[model samples]
Structure formats: structure tokens, C-alpha cells
Target: MAGCGAGEPGDVRLADGGTFRQVLGLEIPNFHPYRDQVAAVYSTLLYDSLVNVTPENKVVSGLAGKWSATTTSAEFTLRDDVTCSDGTPLRAADVANALNHQRDPALAPAAAAALATVPSFTADADDVTRTVKIRMAAPYSFIVRLLGTRPIVCPKGIAAPADFEKVSAGTGPYVLTGYTSGGPYRLEVRKGYHWGPDGARTDEPGVPAAIVLSVVPTPATAANQLIAGDVDAFYTPDPDSVRAPGPEVTKVEVPAVTGMASFNQRPGRVTGDPLVRRALLAAVDPGQAAAVATGGKGRPARGVMAPAAFCSGDTVSANRPAHDTAEAARLLDQAGWVPGADGVRVRDGKRLRLKIVTFATSAQLRATAEFLAGEWKKLGADAVVEEVTVMAFITVTQQSGDWELALGAGVTGSLPSDAVPFFSGPIPPRGRNAGAIDNAEYLRLIGQASALPDEASCPVWQQAEAALVKRADVVAVAETTAIWFARKTRFQVAADTTIVPTSIRLIRG
Candidate 1:
């Protein structure tokens, strides 16, 4: 047995004399399952969604062996042989308990809001059926995809819903062995785990043996760790970091989750002024911003829908807004904004100065904010970038709704349906619609799109997106780039459409 010292370079022998070691650089803001704003690195490793989007962006079966859905109801049949990390049988009751607990308003408000449409969930254990039934309020077509993509079932033995928050108890291949609520989180392979896709696991090989996640908030540190052979892989938003010279590393780029600056449309600050919002959009150079923010790794976004899918060819890239100081000045001038003695625009005795807040954790975002501030200044608008912690940033954006503008990212697994919450009215408190935009026409179109289940829905979504663009509630800056840098040449890693890493397998020589 050999012990490896901290910050040591090169290969070190393990206790069992295995020469292989894979280190992963994980940049995480927070890891709490419920309260934390960002998804925990451990969550992905410890919980298996009922369904998952494959490397090709197609939905595939996960924990639920098979499932069927009607217009208003859905059902899932559990695998008979699956067991939790503790060797507890994963019965239908366990799945039901997880859903029921999530549905409880007191226990989990976020999950409750997501599942509010579900009328009921019934589990049947008789005759070894292992069936879980769900009744929805309406024909929620996206429910199947949502359920398949992110349902983390809990065992029935957990006495309280709060127990789930502290315990990583699921029937996945990996189990939580250690966790720190807001920082580092770690997981280890669950021995004797029996539930994965057929051929996914072999009886002789057993589980992964160990899985660890180190939450390094700095991208530089993450990259350094990967290069030093401290981590097997890491996620980076800046393309430059991934492109930086490194040894035994590979980079894989996928469609990025969209990033934008949202304005709260409610009546209050300059954000409530349509002219100010439009001016802000016109003043931004999305192309240059993308180049700087993502190291030219991102594509300038034209509309709400990702350009890669469902985008109409007629939608011209030139029509995609960019930095035009002259146009921004004209718009501001038309809105009765006059340049004051300080070279800042003013309307009705109010300075055009605005506070632009973003997360301090993301270096790219901070740099983008500075770039935007300069661009906004050229248009006679005073802008300041306020860097805050992830939790505080989310709170201010959601609770006070006082932010003039926010630079952030939107994560979606599908089209149309995923875009619904961003524009729909009666917006979920603290939901993605930080803009608080209330357009009756846009809301109506969103409703119409949700009811539609085929290609026809594309136009409806496009129309709604165009309306949002016209309103300038939020400016779509860039399509996210999900790049995975791996050091191991023997392993194959594929990037999924959801920007998640998948199809990982060891290529034996």
C-alpha cells in the first residue's frame, strides 16, 4: 500500500497496487439538494433519473425499466431486482414516498412547485406489480420528459422528508459517503448495487470502487488540478481554460445552456422603462461579449430558442442585436433621455446609471459585466458590476426583484416546454423569469405551445420568443458551450445535448 501526498505530481500506487487514478476537477458553488441554488455534484452521481437524455439528446430508460403515458396520466414499472446502497429493496413504495415527499409543500417548496400539476401518485405492491401511477391536472406532455430526466426516488424507510436532505439514499450505482452543505461533496461506489441498464454492470467487475467530487470554485484551480493529475476531469465555462496547454487532457464541447441578462419588468427602477431596456440591449455587443466570456467558444444567440434546433432559416444573424452605440443613443434620445453634465443619460430627473449584478464565482461573468459596463457607458448610460456570492445573488434576483440587470445562465433539457417558465405569467416566485415580464399575448402563446405536442408547436414557441425579444425583457447573449476535458486516453466520454457528460466507458487495450 502507498500513500499519495497532497499536491504531489505524477502517478502514485494505490493500496491495492492499482496504477490507475482518475481525478475530476469540480467547480461547485453549493451542494445542498434543496436550499442550494446550484445542483450538487454529488446529486448527479448518487441519484439516477427515471429517464435520462442520451448522448444523442434522445430520451432513454433509466431506473424505471419502462414507462407509458396517456393524455393526463403516466405510469412507471420498477425493476424487480434493484436495491439501494444500503442493500434495501427499491420497491414501488419507495418511489411513491419520494414523489409524495417532494410534493409536500412544507418539506420541499422547490420540488412542490415543479410537481404541483400532479393530482396524485399511487403505488401498487400487490401481486409483485411494482407499479407507480400518476394523475395530472391536464395533458402535461412535458411531464414524461421531466420525470424521466430528474426524478430522484427515495426509499420508503426514510421516516421524514428532511432525512432525504441530509442522507444520500438512492438506488444509484454511487452513494454519498461524505458531504459539506455549501462546499466539498464526495461519493463512493455502492457495493452490490444491482439496478442499471442491462449490460451496464458486470457481476465480476463490481461497482466503480470509489467516486470523489472536490468542489474547487476557481476555474484556474480546477484546470491546474486536472493538469497535475489531481482530478480526472472538470467543467469550465471559459473556452480559454479548456484550450490552455495541458498534459493528457481532452476537451469535449456541447451546446451550452443559454446565458443572458434579465431585467425585472415590474414598475420601479430603470428596468421598468422599455426604452432603457432596449437601449441596454442595443448597447451590448453579444458577439464580442461571447468571444471574451467564453474565449470564442460560444456562438452568439439570436433568439430564445437555441439556434442549433428549431430555428427558422429566415431568422437572420444580422437581425440578432449587437453593440450599436449610435442606435442605442438614438433610442435613448427618443425616450426623452438627455445627457447630463456627468455624461450620463437622464430621464425625468433620474440618472440612467444602473447596477448590473452577477455571480462572483464565475470569472467569465465578471469579465463580461465589465465589458458590458464599458459598452453601456459609450451609450451614455452609467453601469456598475456588482459581484456577489451565488446564494446572495439568487436571493436578490428573486426576493427583492430590485436588480436593474443580471448576467446569468439558463439550463434547459428540451425546447418549447423548457422555454415556458421564462415567459409565462403568474411566474413562479423566484423562478427563472427574474424579469417579471407580463405580456398577455406572450403568456397566451406559451399556453398554446404547451398544449401542442408536435412540430407545429415550433412556430408558436418562435412567435412567443420573438415577442420577448421585442420587449427586451431579457437579452439572449450566447448559446452555452459545455466542454469536458479528460486526461485518460483509455476512457471515452461523450457530450449529451443537455450539456451533461455521458456514455463514459473504459476502452480496454
Candidate 2:
């Protein structure tokens, strides 16, 4: 297979001149649409969003041709040429079904909660006009971008919510040709996909051919496979693995979603005390955590919002709360926590000890938690690290609120609404606010921000971020560096802000 130049489409002509083959390795745990763990990689390939983001972080057309908005509602003009993998033409009814499916508690509970603010969606179609009208419940500033991130469904394939767990059907670039519950999954191009300019084919050579994604948990095994030429790519959060000495491969690090320690601000935990939470924040050394987590390849974070775009370079007071062991101890003492004989703090006969749960699959997160435990000990706090599988952590923390603190990561494209669920409280129990945070002021601000227009929403988001930072419900620790290793040396990979794999096909000689 020969590599093509940038902007030029490459085709792998077969002996029969009918089919092509493009093979790549992907790390995915499962294919459930609602779960964010492994669904991101698969969703982009097998399903279509209403709008698409370019390498430059600009919004472009995806399933919707164009969109318009009023002060109270937004409407999208659907494209008629799009079709699902099952050979059904993508229509306004399909979009309506997908939105309604997301709202269904059984099909996608998490997504539905995040989008609870949406009162309703009405789809109106006109055969002569070749367009679909999507009327929202209220004027949503990020409606276009939100729809772009939504998963387009095939109404005929999924009649019930139970079907989502077993079936994968969408009108995206790729189709699920093969899938296994705990092993590898395969996707093939949906012939005549009409979403993109040249149709929705990923830029990889023979990409329209097939995409094979295998879940390899062990870093050593994944690295060995890449070296042995068994796979074309591998997903590992560690930057060192991509930079390690190797042959027949090249490494590329794109921006990825960030990880943070979200506090469950319920009445029972240590988080119930404001001073205790402040002390924990003051105790953490983000610089050290970043160094240990990514081997000095990660960026320290100051708030929930990433610094890439919304961060203002204005000179603020440098004396704001930061790493200070003495300050942390002082705050804990002020909050009536007394040090015990074991060197851990205790208050009201109960030790000021808490269990910090994090996903074991991510090497960076696990290491960061260990480092945090040691740092908290210096402040007379006993911090226990509990490493659990991604599913277990989600089930216990997000679903049951059984954990005190958990390590998590999320990627928000250039939209504020994308980050809403993380801070919004009224969103169902299992919503993104797994922290159990319920702040009336914060909720009001989020609602206000969502209703504002794009130009006016920026300041609203800035104010909301400031409120989150002041409350200390969740603290952003580091910005992840996505390292990608490629075997083809002749092509240059395009770098972008999106954590999702895009512009992979734009690799050129």
C-alpha cells in the first residue's frame, strides 16, 4: 500500500478491482454507545454527529447541511443523501429517533441526563424541499455543536433500548462488520456515505476497506505487537512508551482529554467540610503529579476549563491558593481536625481518612493517585488509593455514589455545553456530576450560559468556571498528551485539539 500526498485521496486497487484493505490497531474496552470509556473511538468511526470539527477546531457540516437559531429554539436542515450501513436512507425521522433513544433511560442513561435541559425535539420533513427541521425546546447556544456530537441512529435496527448493547448501527464513515464483547472489533466502510466532501471515509489508505480495533491492556504486549508488525497503531496513555527506542514506527502526540479528581460533595464525606476540601487542594502539587504521571510530558491545570482556548493570559494575583503543606495543615486544624498517634488527622473520634478510587487501566491516573496519597500524608491526612477496573469504578462511584473521590477524564470540543454535565447537579443521579455536587448557584449559572448565544456565551462560561474553581468540587490536575506511533515514515500526520482520531487519512508523503 503506497501513501498518498495531502488532500489527495488514495485507493488500494485489488486483484478484482472491487475492494480495498486498510488495517490499524485501536484500544477499545467495549462498544456500548452510552459509556464514554471505549465508546469515543468507536462512535466517531461507526456513527455520525450532527456537526463535525475540523483540525483547526472549527465546526463544519456532518449529518446536518446547515442550521439556524432563534432566541428560543434552533433548527437543522438535514441532508438527504446520507444512508445508514443497513442501506436505509438517513432521514429526519432517524435523527428524531436517535435523540429520543438517548433520552431513554435504558438506552443511554448518562447522555440523557446530560441533555435533560432539552425539553423536546420535533422533526418536520418536506420531500420536495429535501430538508428536515429540528425544533429544540429552548434557545440553546451550543445546539448545533451538541447535535454534531450526537450519535445518529438507524430506527429500523433498534426497536428497543436493549438492542443498543448488542447492536451497532449508525450513519457514519464506518460500519460494524465484526465485533466481540471483550476482544477485537472490526468496521468496514459504508459505501456511498454522503456526510463529508468525498463521502465520510477516514483519511487512512484502504480506510474505507476495514478498521480492526483490538483491546490490549498490557503496555508491554501492545508495544511488542507494534514492533513485531502485528499492528499498525496502539493506544497507550504513557508518553514514554511512544518515545521509547523502537524501529519501523514513528511517534506522534496529539492533545487528549484531561484527568481530574472529582469530589463527591455529599453530607457524609470529608468533602462536606469546605476547609477540608480547601486543605486537600492546597496539599496537592500539580507540577509533581504531572511529572510523575506523564514523565514530564503533561501540563498542569488550574481549573475545570482547559487552558488551550478559553484561558486568558491576563495577570491575576499570583498569591491565590496553591501547593502549601503548612497552609493545608493550618486549614485542617482550623476545621477541627486533630492529628492522631498514627500521624493521620482525626475529627470527632473518626479518622480523617478517605478512599481515593481511580481506574486501573490508565497508567497515568494510577501513578498520580499514589503520588497524591503520599502528599496528603504530609498534611496529616490518610489517603488510601483504591485501584479498580473502569466499569467497577463507574458503577460504584457514578451510579451508587459509594466512593469518596475518583480519578476521571473528559474531552470537551470547543463548546462550553460539552462541559456542562460535569458541573450541573440536577442532571440525574448517574450524570457526569458523579461528584454528587448540588449547588443552586452553579446550576443557575450553567442554565444561563446554555441559553446565551455563542458570542455572548463566552463570558457566561468564564463566570461559571470561576464559580466551580471557588467551590473546589473538582480540581483539574493535568492535561493529557496523546502519543501516536506510526509505521509509515513517508507521511506527515496532522495535529489537532480534538482527542478523537481525525485527520489520520491526511497523512501524506
Candidate 3:
């Protein structure tokens, strides 16, 4: 323990060569970035993107040393020294084809977020120049940020993606050497590796030589391990579950829009009507639901994008409907849906019914769904709750298109453009826009914003977010400051709590 070194003066030195242990909390079903959007969870551990963006929209070097972008096209010159985990030199063609493979929506359904920004795009690699050129389907304001962060699968994994279910392929500092279903994942540091964000190197003092990831089911259990010095770090929305952490522990609160009332706007659904959507949003007390979701440790939500987003503004405060059940009753009554004998509204002989669904395994998420249902029931609606696994979430929300509202279904990211695909693109099966939101004004503004350069497009982008909130199409109630606890380790994370793999440093006594 005495071999470890610390960053600041007056602190003990932390160790240089030890395996950093962590309770992943989240599931890692696959490592193939194209197969699922969740693939980005552990992506930094085994893959490196072309470039990285800071909280202020500052573009930094990543796998690509240099790059340039415009409204409809961009190019990245890969680092010549980069190599795959298998020890082979990474080729521009291999990664370019990887980008092109996503052009087919069918092949990259889960990772369709890239295509969401631009409906179509083409990628070509120039071996001679070590350059990868991309042409977007339409004008895109944030092309660099989107394509830059996407992990590139090496040719080996790209050729046989199914193998990725048990293996990984990329040019990251760490290589996946051990894995199993419902077991700890093991990764070893790649010696002589570089190309990390902001010039992070593996051999740096205090950096771990290896990492061990285990899926701990409960927040209390994981937090206990962290405090006991048995684990390095863990994050939890319900921080109250953890006993008071001592001074040795570092707790970072990441503010993010975590509570949302996502209505299914598919044709024939009760939430399809904007009036009903507004009524539903007004009936539920955002403050109360948010409290239940985060164990009374949450603040009011600000907007669709987190505060870390460069263009994020207070869109919700100005656009959100005030909580008023009487207003809710009046809206439904005006729509000719009068309350029946049993208090359930009846519209043309149809009983008003609603179902809330959640894919989260946390008890807090399920409790939030129940809380929303109770509020809807008071509005004379037959409200029920349904819980589903993450694997089945897309199937229900996208393919089956059942249910009325989604509890844990809101989108969260660091850019205004990050919300476009989930709100505007092709609806489910074809895309992840399960809500089937058809806001012409929002869609039009997105087009205008996309054609402009970064900072110059903030006004139009903010207007687009207002359009969604004003319609009650996407109502966010609360912001949960997810707590990230660390002991003998140090690292940085995004607003949504995604860890910076290269930033991790394991400390010793």
C-alpha cells in the first residue's frame, strides 16, 4: 500500500502497478459498438474514438491527430503509430468500412445514433494519406462531435461481429483478455500504447496496470465495497442508500436529466393527442415523482440537454406546463372525455387507460413508474405499471409500440444535436424514436441549425428544444445528481457518469 502515490502535495504516494477493481453496476452484454448503443458503456476501455470533446465544445486529439469538418462533410487523419489490440497496424480502410457499415440502418440499429444526426452518410479511406473522409446525408452542425466519439471496431471484429459478444477489437490502451456471462471482466494494459485523450499515457505514475470489472446488483452493496476499500469506485442515483462516506472518500455529483415522462405518440395511442399529452404532464407532480426517483436527492430538471452541454438552456422552466389536476380535468373534459361512474374517463364508450413502462432494474426506477401511474389514476385514467428487462425495452417501445408512457426512457447527452435522432428520426424497428414524435416546427428548426457552424447555431438549436417541451411531447420533471464515489482511485466522468478510462489511477497506502 505504501508504494502508491497521490497527485497533490501533502498526500500519500499511490501505487503504479496494480489492478483497479470496480463494481460496474451496469450490464455488458456485448462489446460490438454497432450492435447496441450500450456498447459505448465500456467502449473507452477497449476502443478509442477519432477525437474527444470537452464540456466547452473544445475538440481534443484522440485516435486522430488532426481533423476538419463542415456542415455536410468531414475528414480525420489517423495517427500512423496506432495499432489494434492484436498488435497489427490499424488501416484507414478498415475503420472507414466500419463507419460505412453503419450506413445500413439494419446492421447498426442500436448504434443508429450516428445516422440519427444525418439520415445517410458515406465514408472512404485513403491509405496513402492515412485519412478517413465522410460525407453526411444532410447539413450537420455537430458532425465532428458525433463521428469523433464513435468507437472504431478493428477489421477482425468487423468481419465477424458475433464474436464480439465474447471478445473485443480496437486500438485502446487496454485489451480484453477474460470475460464470461454474469462474471467479472478482465483487461490488461497494452504496453507501449498511446493515443489517449489529452495525451494520456499508460505508463504514467499512479496509472493502473490492469482493471477488473464486476457487476454488483445493489447500490448499497457496491457503495459498501467502495467504503471498505474492497472496490475503487461506484456510482448511484440513490446516494442515500450508502452510509455516510468518510473524508477519505471523494463524492462527485453529476447533474443530469434523469426523470422524464415519455409519451408514446404512435397512431391510435391515447397519448397521441397533444392535448392529452399536456394533460398527462400537468397531472403528475414533477417534484414528487422526482423525489421518489432519487430518494429525495434531486433538483428540478433544466432542459433536454444536461448543463454540461455547450448549448443547453433553461428550456423547461419557460415551456413546461404547471402542475394542475384541475387543469388536467378541464383539458380532458374539453376533449369530450368525461369522467364515468367509476371515476375513469370515458371517451365515446372507450375507457381511458394508461400503462407506464421502465427498463431499469433499480427499485427507485420502478417506484417512479408506480408514482406516475398513481397520479394518472387521480385524473380518472385506468393507469397500470409494467417493468421490462433492458433487452426487451426496445422490442416493447419500438417494435411492439405498446404502453402509454416510459418512466426511464428519456435521452441524456452533452450536446443539443444528441437529442435530434431520438426525437426526430424514423420511428422504431426502423429507429429508436419509439415515441413517434412528429413535431414539424422542431424538425424544421433542426434542419436550419444543422446547416450552420457550431456556436453560430445555438439559437436555432435552443428553439428546437423549446418546441419539444412546449408541446408536452417530452416532459422532464427532475434532475438527479448521480453520486460517483471513489477511494484510492482518481478519474473523470461525463455529465451522464461515463468514466474516462485513461483517467483512472489506482492509489495505494
- RMSD to true structure for each model, in Å: 5.9, 4.6, 3.2
Collision pairs in model 2: 50-148, 51-148, 72-139, 203-505, 204-505, 252-484, 491-508
| Whole-model lDDT values for every prediction | 0.58, 0.61, 0.79
Candidate 1: regions farther than 4 A off: 1-42, 113-128, 156-158, 180-183, 197-199, 202-207, 241-243, 257-259, 303-327, 361-363, 410-416, 422-432, 454-459, 489-509
Instruction: Give the per-residue lDDT of model 3 (tens digit) for 1-509.
Output: 01112345247566899988878765677767788676666787888888887544578998789999988899999899989988889889987888887666676665665466574778899999999998888888877787777788888887888887667888888888888777588889988877888677898877788888888867888978877888878877657666787778876666666656678999889999888888888897778877887778776687877766768788887788889999999999887789999999999999998988885565777888888888889899999988886557667877888889876634666778777777877886666678998899999998999899778889889999999999988877677766788787777776446777777777676
Q: How many clashes (backbone atoms < 3 Å, residues ≥3 apart in a chain or on different chains) does model 3 have?
A: 7
Error of 3 at 288 (Å): 4.5
Q: Per-residue lDDT for 1-509 in model 2, tens only?
A: 12222223433221111122223233444455654434643477667777776544456787777877654555667787777777777777667666666766555664666565554565556545545566767666666656545776677545653455545677776666676766567766555555752234444443325556666665556667767766556545455543363655666555554566777776588876768887887887767876766667776764454444432221111322577888988999999998999888888999888788987766777888888888888888778998987667767776776666777654343555555666664523646666767666666776787678665777776666666666666666766665555443222222223224323442322
| lDDT of candidate model 2 versus the reference | 0.61
Candidate 2 Cα outliers beyond 4 Å, as residue runs: 1-37, 117-123, 160-167, 197-208, 241-247, 256-259, 303-320, 400-402, 409-414, 426-430, 489-509
- Count of clashing residue pairs in every prediction: 7, 7, 7
Q: Candidate 1 overall Cα lDDT vs. reference? A: 0.58
TM-score of each: 0.81, 0.83, 0.92
The per-residue C-alpha lDDT of model 3 at residue 353 equals: 89
Off by over 4 Å in 3: 1-10, 285-297, 359-367, 387-395
Better of 1 and 2 by lDDT: 2
Q: How much does candidate 2 score in TM-score?
A: 0.83
| Backbone clashes in model 1 | 7
